[model samples]
Target: MSKLLNDDVKEMLTNILKDMVDEVYVKVYVDTLTCETCTETHQLMDEISELSDKIHYDLVETHGDKTVGDKYGITMYPTMVVLDKNQEDKGIRFNGIPAGHEINSLLAALVDMSGKPLDLDDATIEAIKAIDTETNIKVFITLSCPHCPGAVTKAHRIAMLNPYVKAEMVEAQTFHEFSAKYNVSSVPKIVINDTHDFVGNQPMEVFLDTIREAA
Candidate 1:
């Protein structure tokens, strides 16, 4: 098969990845029987890891190994749980292939998880920390959508800041059944706790407001 990332894109990603400060450990769960993009996802991780020494990735065959899956509560195929230098699952995850424009989220995660923190005001950071309720954010997206990456990145940023919250980027086209369950017709649909949801690349305040309103 041809390489998932061509040389030009690889060079661009390599240059962009030079911003990483520390190392990132990405645990990729592969499901061969059902996931169509599993091969591409694995290849993407390999290509990405090769680009930066600060980034590291390993594959876990879900059918055989259940250690990481059992700990992280991940059941879906082609899921990637990203960890920082601490190697802890701070709920930084992707439920599908982060391709096309969605690669922005992956790149952001790589940088942030490595060392950089989210650029938010002190008050906003405190507000995110003060939220005690457990929240599950699922940002449904498609690979081609231009606006979806921002939404996914916002969700993940919140998750990274708050231990009580966990976010996942669900690729709508690949996981059609899951998207249909949420009635996801749009590209960037932000669903919280299977209840509160809104569409588009809403601002950080709006995301906080919706999360606060989630039951």
Candidate 2:
């Protein structure tokens, strides 16, 4: 297959990744037998990693023991889990090929996970860190959706701040059955803990309200 990123795009990403202060790792889980987008997902990781010395990825196959996938709570193929500079899981994931506008979220995640502090107030950061309850945030989106990246970026930022919270970007089209379970009729549907859900690229406070309720 041809390269997913062309020369100009690669140049832009190279500059953006230069802001990374520390190394970041993305573990991509795949099952060749069952995953249709697994190949493209792996290729995308490769292309992104090539743009920066601070970025890397390990291709993990979920065909046998499933230990790695279990460790990361990855039950789906073509899932990319972003780890911090210390190679620790940051509860940030993309459960499909992050092409189109979703690519912005993936890039932002890599930069944010690399020892950079989130641009949030101290009180807001403390609030996120203090949430002791287990929180799961799933942002259902299609690759083409223009507004999806904003929602995904916000969810992932919260996840990066608190280990108790897990955030994932689920490509609705790729995971149609799972999307149906949430009745994801619109793009950028935000689901918290599988019970409280709302649609749109809502503000940070709105997201926190739903998360607080879930907590």
Candidate 3:
């Protein structure tokens, strides 16, 4: 089969990952029997791992490795769990194929897992650090959406900063049931704790305030 990422893309990834200070392991959970994109997602992650020593990946079959899947709360195929250098799962999840603009979100996740600080304002970071209540954030997105990455990155950063936050980037097309349930007609729909939700990309301060209010 052909490579998932081209030479230029590989080179770009290499450069971006070269500054990584810690190791990042991407654990991909897949159910080969039901997932059409499992092979492609595996191949893509494998090629990405080759770009940097700091990056590595493991493919876990959902049925065959139920314990591991269960440990990560992976109920869907093509779910990526980004672990920090110590192999700690901070609840950074990606449900569905990370292609197109979502690829940028994938890269940002790697950077975050590598212990690199997010580029948010100091005040924003402090506010996130102050969040003591558990917050589960799901940002529904489609691969083709140009504006999806920004929202995904922000949510992931929030998860990285606060231990109370668990963020997921859900591909709406792959998980149609969730899209229907949440009424996600548009992309980048932010769902917080299944109680509060909103559509479109929100500013960092506004997003933080929203979570605080929901909590």
The digit string of per-residue lDDT tens for model 2 on 66-176 reads 576888888888899999878998789999999999999998998889977677898888878887899999999999999999999999999988888999999999999
Model 1 poorest ten-residue lDDT run = 61-70
lDDT of 2: 0.90
What TM-score would every model get versus the actual structure? 0.96, 0.96, 0.95
Candidate 2 TM-score to native: 0.96
Per-residue error (Å), model 3, residue 21: 1.3
Please give, for residues 10-78, the per-residue lDDT of candidate 3 as tens digits. Answer: 989889887788999889888888888888888888998998889988888776555668787888788
lDDT of each: 0.89, 0.90, 0.88
Distance from true location, Cα of 4 in model 1, Å: 1.4
Q: Which stretches of candidate 1 lie over 4 Å from their true place?
A: 64-68
List model 1 lDDT by residue over 1-215, tens digit each: 78888999999998889989999999999877667888889998998899999998889877645465887888787999999887988898899999999998999999988878677889888888887999999999999999999998888888888899999999999889989999999879999999999999998898999988994
- Candidate 3, which ten residues in sequence have the lowest lDDT sum? 61-70
Clash pairs, candidate 1, are none
